[model samples]
Target: MVITYIAGPISGNIDINKQAFLNAADQLQSSGRVVLHSASLPVGLTEPQYMDICFAMIRACNEMVMLPGWRQSTGATAEYYYAKKIGVVVRDFNQTLKVSR
Candidate 1:
């Protein structure tokens, strides 16, 4: 199965962004897609720490599904570029899923 990682903003509005990530995950799962994400990262981690884990998670996936407004997120933007760099399929939730890499 090609696992898809959920990427979105989580710093300024953690609750809302996490919900968005979870919603994205649920939608993908309903379509029988396996998902990889760290929306529920362990507590007390710094921004870099969270991204460290997120980056590792993305490496394990075959694709990445970026949430709306991902470009405004430092982390999600990085994830999108990284996915392209490593050849992971990139798609957007704001529009129909299309390969960007």
Candidate 2:
């Protein structure tokens, strides 16, 4: 099974971010892909700490699925670039969903 990391904004409107991640993760799981979403990251961690954890998860995944508004997030952007640097497949959430559906 393909392991996909879900990267998106989490600083602003956390509820919306969490919901979006959950919905996308559900769809991805239904399609038989293993998902690593950051929505459940422990609260109260510093930005650097969060990124450290997220980057580790990214390294473990086979690919990354970037959600809409990811460009506006520093953490997501870092994940994107890191994934590129390490040759991990990077996909857009909408495109992945379209292909799966």
RMSD of each: 3.1, 0.8
For residue 36, what is the lDDT in candidate 2?
94
Q: Which residue pairs overlap in candidate 1's backbone?
A: none
- Model 1 has an lDDT value of 0.81
**How far off is residue 6 in model 1, in Å?**
0.7
Task: State the lDDT at 55 in candidate 1.
Answer: 90
Which lDDT tens digits does candidate 2 get at residues 1-101? 79999999988999988999999899999999999978978789888889889999999999899999999999899999999999899999999989887
Q: Per-residue lDDT for 10-91 in model 1, tens only? A: 7788888888888888878777778888787877988789888989989999978878888898888988898899999887
Clashing pairs in 2: none
Worst 10 residues of 1 by lDDT: 92-101
Top candidate (lDDT): 2
In each prediction, how many residue pairs overlap at the backbone (N, C-alpha, C within less than 3 A)? 0, 0
The global C-alpha lDDT for each of the candidates, from Candidate 1 onward, is 0.81, 0.92
TM-scores for every predicted model: 0.88, 0.96
Cα shift from native, residue 22, model 2 (Å): 0.8
